[model samples]
Target: MAQNIIHLVNVSKNYNGTEALRNINLYIRKNEFLTLLGPSGCGKTTTLRIIGGFEAPDGGEVLFNGVNITSVPPYKRRVNTVFQKYALFPHLNVFENIAFGLKIKKMDKKLIAEKVHNILGLVNLSGFEQREIDSLSGGQQQRVAIARALVNEPEVLLLDEPLGALDLKLRQEMQIELKNMQQRLGITFVYVTHDQEEALSMSDTIVVMKEGSIQQIGSPIDIYNEPKNSFVADFIGESNIVSGIMLRDYLVKFAETTFECVDHGFKENEPVDVVIRPEDIQVVPAAESKLQGEVSAVTFKGVHYEMIVQNNSTRWKIQSTAMAPVGAKVGLQILPEAIHIMKKVTVK
Candidate 1:
């Protein structure tokens, strides 16, 4: 079993009396790529900061290697951060920028040069040693910032939306690069981002947050396919969420029709939330299906067309290769495996 490198025990934080984190209990395993995913004000960034020792929680403790370190300063912790704004020295070249930390420790010149070159090579910038910071592109500068943080060989790396400043194409490219880099380095990564696709693409485990609290934690596939509630289903991707009743194990009633589902564990006749992904819904001829809806909208989305079908007050978003014309009656076939039943959540 992999040992946990860090743990936040009942951690809570506040900013001017408003809660930033609410009793967040989290553990980061060694050498795993974990992402804290949520929207703004969700406290993903604040969680990362707490782990990096940049911010301290108002209650509870932070543990590093099983030892309490809640009060430790940022510089003393065995972690480093890479922020959205790649904080490189404007006057310094790439070499000087990466070497600043080692030099500040008063290390020998030859050793600093060796470490700087090696780190630059890891970041694929070996030949750009003398290039000025301003001379590099956004991607290159971000690489420099990452290299500087990684050069110190911290046990964990906290990234706060580091790719938010890059263009879409470059950001996607860096996603692959960063994942590969983390695998090659064999280090723990606690990344924070509001982008769901980015979190899904690069994470081994995802912690989804909402309103300063963690909503769910699981592997990306599990989070998407088996969301704990409607909030997770609606946030992780495009989902058709509807109120339903669990008629029995493997059976549910929604849209005035009963469906055979793969989920259970709910009380008999219990009200639940049904989550069906857009792609999981199969479109068929209305005459062949018991349930039918009228096509209200159709949108071409590259490989597939997104369709909105209206059945009374319920609007279903379905994705299919074939497009049904608006006003056409279509059948939505939700297979047993595609129907995900979740416990309904009540807000206080």
Candidate 2:
């Protein structure tokens, strides 16, 4: 088992009386890629700031290697942050920017050169050492920011939406590059982002957050497949969520239909929320299946067709390779495993 390298114990923070984090308890394993994911004001960034020593929590402890370091300053911690804004010095060349920290420590001049060269190579900018910061593209500049942080050889790296400024294609490319870099370096990465796809693709563990609290923490697969509630299901991907009742073990009733699902442990006849992914639903001929709907809207989504099916008051979004014309009656087939059942939440 991997040992934890960082822990946030009952951490709470507030910004001018508005709670930013409430009793957040988290454990980050050494050398793992963990992402704190949520929408704006959900405390993901605040949590990252706390870990990076940028902000101290109103209450609780921040531990590094099981040692409390809540009050430690950012510069004293063995971690560096890469923000959305690269913050590269406009007048400095790539080498100078990356070597700034090493020079501050007054390391051997030759050793600083060696570290800068090595980090530049790692970030695929080996030949751009003398290039002025302003001459580099956005992606290259972001890489320089990362290279600067890595050149410090910190044990952990904190990233706050580092890819947020890039174009769609560049952002997608950097997502893969960042994951590869983390794996190659064998260090802990604590990332903060609101992009669900980015979190799912790059993180080993994903912590879902909501207003001032952590909602769930699990592997990307677990978080996507077995969401704890409707919010996670809706946020992580395209889901058809509706009110349901657990009729009995392995049985659920929703949309006036009783179906067999692989969910249990709920009280008999208990209310629940059923989450069905758009990709899990198969579009079939209406005559062959029991549940039917009219395809009210259809759009080609490159890999598949996204069809909005209307069955009276409920609208379901489904993705399938087979195209069903709008206004045509179609059937939806949801397998037992795809029918994830989550406990319902009460609205405020």
- Report the number of the highest-TM-score candidate: 2
Residues 265-314 of candidate 2 have per-residue lDDT tens digits of 99999999999999998888888777789999999999999999999667
RMSD of 1: 1.8
State the lDDT at 153 in candidate 2: 72
RMSD to native for every prediction? 1.8, 1.5
Per-residue alpha-carbon lDDT of candidate 1 for residues 8-28, written as tens digits (9 for 90 to 100)? 999999999889999999999
Error of 1 at 85 (Å): 3.2
Candidate 1 structure, TM-score to reference: 0.94
**Model 2 accuracy (lDDT, Cα):** 0.91
TM-score of 2: 0.95
TM-scores of all predicted structures: 0.94, 0.95
Instruction: Give candidate 2 misplaced runs (Cα > 4 Å).
Output: none
| Reference-based lDDT, each prediction | 0.90, 0.91
